[model samples]
Target: MTRHPEVLWAQRSHKIYLTIALPDAKDVVIKCDPEGVFSFSATRADGESFKFDLELYGGILLEGSKINTGLRNIICSIKKENKVWWKRLLKSEGKPAPYIKVDWNKWCDESESDTHDSDDDYIRGNSEDNDSSEDDGLLYLPDLEKARRN
Candidate 1:
């Protein structure tokens, strides 16, 4: 069954993990802060998890803001193993089709390795076509960093 975003889940203090099953692979734990910022971890179904900051546009907007707010859209690029499943899972919620890589840190770097290659016409074409730098993947901050420094 597809889970709707409006379904309000219990709120936890940066520790509550929501486990959602992928199509044919391991289930990933959705971890988030009290404010609703979310990150995913996949070390195990239930174990030491590494929080990944992979959202394309920083944070998801839960409510409509004066400038921009309303049902924040989450974004993340998954690994090859999880791509197919993720596509199916997020087909609904208007999820973008793997634009920028934030969750897969290693893959993102690897994919961009040839950006400096001189022979590759495709890479050169990209540079010539779009002069501006693409979004630098996603920025990940440790949960501790979110703690209020009182």
Candidate 2:
């Protein structure tokens, strides 16, 4: 029996990031067509087969799409033909499959996309001229007792 791997997706206006979570996958095959069809298949070391097909929300630039296989996941960077934000990942969506999910870590809101190129940029912007000795962008809250004393 074939299994569907968990897929996480995030998008920028011009590109989509698709991540297939399958550790130690072997004999992987991925295909993306200009008509917005994305297909993937792979086998695990134990001989279990995994596969899925996604009809993407919009047409893609086939020549610009890329795939990278890693020990933990396969990442596909798909360039959009129209260079606009998609309403959702799948074309025929009522609700997406259970295995598919939004990649919150990589997701940037359309409103914020212009202000920050990425999460790192937002962090860096917050940290600029930070009074703390540590250069980490995280804000440290003052202790309640210390604030009360002051």
Top TM-score hit = 2
* Candidate 2 whole-model C-alpha lDDT, 0 to 1: 0.77
Q: Model 2, range 2-105, lDDT digits (tens) per residue?
A: 99999988877877888889999999999888999999999999999999999999999987566667688887768889878899999996999999999876
For model 1, residues 40-135, the per-residue Cα lDDT tens digits are 544333333333433322223322111101123222212222111122122135644343222222221224434422212211112233454432
- TM-score for each model: 0.19, 0.77
Shift in Å, residue 87, candidate 2 = 0.5
The whole-model lDDT of each prediction reads: 0.27, 0.77
